[model samples]
Target chain A: MAKILIVDDDEDFVSAVNLLLKSNGFDVAIANSRQEGMEIFDKDNPDLVLLDVMMDEPDDGFVMAQSLKKKAKNIPILMLTNVGQVTGMDFDKDSEMVPVDDFEQKPIMPNILLEKINQLLGK
Target chain B: MQIIDRQKVNEQIRDLKKKYGDDRSALMPILQDLQEIYEYLPDVVMQETAHSLGIHPVEVEGVASFYSFLRTKEKQGKYVIRLCRTISCDLAGKSNVARQLENEMGIKFGETTKDGKFTLEYTNCLGMCDRGPALMINDRLFAKVDPEKASQIIADCRRDFLKSDFPKVVPSDVKKAGPILDHDLKPAEAIKKALSMSRSEIINTIRESGLKGRGGAGFPTAVKWQLAGAAKGKNKYVVCNADEGEPGTFKDRMLLYEHTDFLLDGMTIGAYAIGASKGFIYLRGEYLYMKKYLEEALENRRSEHLLGKNILGKDGFNFDIRIRMGAGAYVCGEETALIESLEGYRGEPRNRPPFPVDTGFQGNPTIVNNVETFIDSALIIVKGSEWFNIHGTEKSKGMKIFSISGDCERPGIYEFPFGIKVSELLKEVGGEDTKAVQIGGASGHCISQKDFNRTIAFEDIGSGGSIIVFGPDTDMLQVARNFLEFFVEESCGQCTPCRDGNPKLLGGIEMLENGRCSFTYLNELKKLCETIQNASKCGLGQSSPNAFLSIVDNFKPEILGRVPEAD
Candidate 1:
């Protein structure tokens, strides 16, 4: 089973994502912040990372992702965000400027998110 | 925290100490050097820095946290894309540009890509107002960017990240009535004339010209010099504040570039008048490309004996200038913050009553003049006070350089005498479809179409010369939000009113933007703004609420629409 680390500030979102991932038979870990996420990443060496774009600060997710990448360059990162509704801008997953392997807007359907995770994990 | 190389950190600290000496002010530069070595300021390094400097860890951390450029943690991507979010850029479709980038990148503002290749963030201003929709990938700037162009630029960067070619900016095509000071005068000619006059004569000439500091404060230049000169201090200093971090303002860049000699000569003359042997030019980091040219100018002057010991071959008249680069802080443009940064501390605004002229830069009497102010001094000395006094209004004498950008056919620098009506300036700049104009970056006033008759003078809507035109299609609420956000990010967090109050204002604006604000909440926000304007310690916090107040005052219907309809 692949080890996935979910780093998000929203407890409800994290719990829902955690339940879905566990039912799919993946070992999961959770962190509430960029600092906590990095600590878990260093200890567990997760195969994939699920990150939120905004937490304590608007750019906290990006800052977290950058630090994670510095430690493990090849680990796939899937970013979660509700920024589209807020800023009224669509996110293009194929954008070279975004270092994420995949992007799922907030309030993601469990099935759709699972499909994205599976595809990114090449399972 | 990562275990940094102890020997290496110590050696670097030693080198920094050697370069800046044991003065407490060197704290900012030392921290900057450490930041460069370590991607982020590590805890171990901070402790080590504190130990080496003989200062407490809290001071180091406080200074580090105060500056936006200084990071305590490692969180930078390979390519950091900073999009300009100032009023002028916003008016010129910066949001569209940001939307394009976000859609292209699969990430919103302030996110690093999964591959660690890119980071998208919002920056205060890149000083490229005329060419709006600007963004910077590291130090290189891309202006006039649309969605398509943003995509193309990203593609090019991905293809060859090292040498991605972008459009080069040409100097402003300024329309002038006649040979102004900058255009007509030869380099060092004014300084030569000042050197011939006694120090009192130089000060009197500047006084008679009715010259004022052009750095937005509009303080009388002659009075500032006279105060510094009279102040009881042996090692008096002259500082030229070239940290033009104000959004939509790039006139200083032009002055530093084309007329380098005049700027240096102005500083030299100021140093001579103030009885100061040492001078410093606090250059902004964004304009690091201009450093080579500035250095060359200084080198030429030194060889010609225009600077350094025994200036102009005269005994007992000695002055030398050194360039100090700012590592990215907008508040450093404030004279006290600039001084604080000069002393190697975080760029925090010092409380007044002992102004910079009396107590500045190593607690010495220092006269901090704007880049233009010094250049103007050189001109007044050469051209005579009577000639200089002919232009401008009764209070604000001589011509001012206006950095006009956004919603104009010709968006560039323009030189005009004070008292020019807003409507006249709009017409001259080709702002045909203009709805509003934001003068003096974020801190300055917002002028509506009805107020276009107001003149540009110290008595009227005075400015440091940043005029950003907004078209009818632009949302004034969004413009106000952008300015509020800028203050929230740039505030040094020294006081509660500024650090906390700005974010509250931003939150209120965001609430309105999202159609969640109530009439009661809006009234509360107005009171909060008043408190911030009246209670904040520095000019930044005081002037921060101006845009929000003006937008609400002028465009009440637009903001009211943000409130949900009465049930």
Candidate 2:
């Protein structure tokens, strides 16, 4: 089983995703802010990470992705954010700036999210 | 009129319409150019402009009358001498210079000399607080003007030989420097970095930096960019609010002169992020000395392919910036009022529901950021978010450039982190014996020594970087009176609360000065301040009573039942 780390400020969303990832037979770890996410990333070292675009600030998730990639270059980051819906902004993954493996808007179907996560883990 | 030339007037109006645009927003620059040619706006020329722009003649008159700089009733002198009368200049012996100027010109402040050589006027904050007793003769700024210097300046104007003795770009007296001041990013480096990223990526980089608007209002900069970028609009605008009219604020004036390339890069980056094709720097008429320099910088950027079509060779990313001259209205510092002024209307703020982000500047998505905010955003694009946000407090998250003046031993610009304590700052500026500190300009609070422990942050006491310190001998009542009078002159009269309420507050201060106010009436006046804050239509009106309320709150014991001054 692959371990996944969830870093988002939305606690209820984190809990729901945690349950979904755990029931799918993956180990789950969670952190709320950028600092906490970094500390947990160093501590837990999850195989894949689920991140949010807007945490304490508007683009915390993207900033954290750059940091995480610097720490572990091959670790997959699945950016799940409603920033497009929230601010009506359209964004996609970029190699240098975003550095995420896959991007999806929020309210995704549970099965698709699971399939995306497993595919990133190469299961 | 002085022999109106019909063909010449028609020709000039046509050329102005072609240079600026046929759009209603082109009204201000057109009128400004015409005013330059006619010495003042003549009735016939205004009529020609009105017919050309398809606006009502009455509306044109309304706009001309609203701004203090515009002259419609009579012709102005060739040299317009505007003396700074705001508190900083007042404390620096501005009245003596005024008296000397009046004597030299043989005219009062609001009069033109008989020979039509000079027009004398008093203006609010020429953005020369650190070098006070400053005056502007036409577009040339003369700082530290004493009575003797005033005589020489008048003599120079008479000889028609007033050469710009000062340097082309006046350097800011930066007492203490930090990262933003020390940013060494070259010209267009940030623009190239931004061009490589997507629109949302550009915004996300700024958002990640946690930069807030440095214009005293702590609105998040990234959020403003994001909203403006996402708003439904075929045409969008990024306006740099360069109207540095606050009483003791002079940092923007320095930034415009010193960091010319940085400001242009920041503005270009903002235009790219928001998909804006056109931009404007609504510079205050006080800083008219810096206009040609800024225009030169814009032209240089265009030549370097950092501003014009396909910026840095990026396809379909065409953007250019123009300089708009503000005709001396302090209220136009407010964004909506700036927009109204941009539209060639009275510089009065509009009601917000469709805010500037959604419907602004001719009903398109427009984002107006402060000069400092734009510069900071551009620097953040190159330096990364962690480098910028690491200095200040968690919420405030950046170093703020302070224009420190008044009662301080070392009065100049200082870049201190946002969460610095008042006492710490006073010590740094050799103003430890400070009695009161006006954190913002006239619209900010007058905090006494008791609040010295408080930090300067958005979560604590946020400021737009105008730190005017008052010593022990300074009169607190007089400070309150000066700020109230500023509001009274600056109020747009669009809303009743600000129009009527401010004069009443000034009257109350006068009563306090004459030792005639009762506690009950003073309480009533406080309530009126609250009413003005609650009922005013815009931010300027709401903040009019801030200095008074803060003074009364902080110095209640000294202010109440105070002995009257000797007549």
Candidate 3:
């Protein structure tokens, strides 16, 4: 089973994701804050990460993402956004949506998300 | 995530002052940094800021909490998600957008998800109105959002945590591809148009267009004109409500900045429409830049004979416009309070029946309207009401301007026809992830993804088009607390619920944060929220509890947490 760490302020979503991933034969750990997320990232050796863009703090996820990048440069960062681009910021390079390994919107679809996870994991 | 100490905050302030000079302008960035470090600026932070900079603590505190960037109170959750709910996004179903994030996250507006990982929030105007339903996940903005996109974004963020290391997503270099509106009509031309337009014709034309007020209440522009015009008085006045205190709504600023002449034209049309001789732009003192531009525009018009005893060589529609500054009071936005301020009284709303239209501005018939309402007059005259009607819904005709700010990619002012879907606007603007869209400023509703199909028309948009979008990462609880803090400060201290209840609401949110409040307390507080909305005298009081109410209704579980700890 692939070891995964989940950092998000939305515990319900985290629980659901944990269940979904665990059922799909993956080990999951959850952190509710930017500080905890980063700490866990350093402590636990997870194969992948699921990060929520906005946490209890507005930029918690971004801060964590930056920290993760600083700690390990090659780890894939899948950014989850609930309200997608309210500011109309286009991150796509050459017409393709900017891919930070992978991206997903909120209210996750279990199967679809699992497929993306598998694809990104290359399992 | 950084535990910023006061020393670090002071040092940052000193550095900012050094870089930007000791001028007051340097404080904004310093306060913003403080908010970033502390999540919200505490009272002590303000005092420290003042002590460090050799300024009065009150001044520092005033400036710190005045702008949306400064947060003086603690929020409910560890993570904060501020979603913009303005008109642009409302027409785009920002409520549904917000709701989708709630459902997906298993949270609600102004509530933390059960695990305390996030807090949802609502922001008034993010200044990116053009891209309806904007959101800001931290300092980064993503424009043009929809429900599905919001879910996808959240999922992607979750995936990042699953990885052992933090997500490594570098923001791309931004490219300014769209046309930036940099041109303004010449004062000479604006004056000429203002002079030529006849009073009766302007009224008739506007009446034909079905234009309504852009402010909270959508009153008919033409009927208001006729009443004001018919009122028996020599001391008639035209007052423009430029004191836009509502959060997430800055179309007025855009108009004052980019289309001052149009406002003048509209006011002139209104002046002619209602036979008012003089007009005052009741401008918010916080909008120093907008006031400066408006003053300059007025000066230009006066120099070119567009304001005083004017003649476009044919018709003599003589009128003048003056700018009045508001002393940073939310109550002044109310017509009665605005009038009281002009009369040198404490800014407070008075009893109605002898509405401003009947006995206003020194006991004369007065016409007060929002800046956007006035701007519509010029457009209605230029293009017939039929043309305006073709764009918007039958009841509310014409395109509305929205300041789209928040997590969206493009944060700017957008003009779109009413009834547009929230999802469609997001897709058009390339919003790949949208959590929720807050419509009608902080007082507006929080929409989820399921309601994306809702149209962005007048009846549905709620008030005017101040649309804010949130990315999937937003925490509703923190956002709600932020708005509650605003209410506590912005309240005029008139009614009990609004004045006294504000602190209580803030306290309730705090209790929620401490993990001490009982579920019964929350339920009671929710009831109080409704009572405040129903009994409060003014609009501000009435809508003060909306942020909390929306959260309680939409995201109850998020607010009450899974733990049953009580104080």
Worst 10 residues of 1 chain B by lDDT: B161-170
Evaluated on CA atoms against the true complex, candidate 3 attains a DockQ of 0.01
Per-residue error (Å), model 2, residue B162: 2.0
Which candidate, 1 or 2, has the higher DockQ? 2
| TM-score-sorted candidate list, best first | 2, 1, 3
Task: Give the number of the best model, judged by lDDT.
Answer: 2
Could you give candidate 1's per-residue lDDT for residues B1-567 as a string of tens digits? 356798888898999989877667677768777776776688778888889889998888987877666678665666778888877777778888999898888998878887767888887777778778788886677878898989987887677554423333336546544335346778889988998887756877887898988999998898677656645567889998999988889888778877778888899998888789998889887765566678788898999999988898778888988778787789999999999989878888998756777688888889999998988888889889988789899988888998998887788889989888999999998997799998888898888888999999999999998998888887888788888888888898888988998899899988898999988888888899899989988889899889888888888888898898743
Clashing pairs in 2: none
Task: State the fraction of real interface contacts model 3 keeps.
Answer: 0.00
TM-score of 3: 0.56
Cα displacement (angstroms), candidate 3, residue B366, comes to 1.3
- DockQ metric, candidate 2: 0.08
Residue range B1-567, candidate 2, lDDT tens digits: 389897899999889889898977888898889999999999898888889888898989999899998999999999999999978888888989999999887899899988889999998888889998889888888888899999998888889989764758666799998999986788889988998888777887788788999998888998788767756678999999999888899999888888878888899999998889999999998887788988998888888888889888899999999999999999999999999998888999988766787578887889999999999998999999989999899899989999999988999999999899999999999998999999999998899999999999999998999999998988899889889888999999999999999999999998898888888788899999999999998889999999999999999877885634333
Cα lDDT tens digits, model 2, A1-123, are 788999999998999999998887989999999889999999988999999978876657867887898789999999999876765555567765567899999988899999999899988
* DockQ of every predicted complex: 0.01, 0.08, 0.01
lDDT of 3 by residue, B1-567 (tens): 435577876787788667644654345546655665666777767787778767788877655544443456553344455676644455456888899889877887766676655667676544445555666554345556689867765665566432211132212212221111222334345335544555545665676777878886777787677556644566779999988877776667666765677778778767766667788988874453355557788888777666777434445556788776664566778898888766544566776656687577766789999988877776666656786777678777777766566667776567766667888866655555887777777777777677667777667756575667777767777777767877886787768888898899889888877777788888889889888998788788888887788766666667778326654
- Tell me how far the alpha carbon of residue B55 in candidate 3 is from the true structure, in angstroms, after superposition: 30
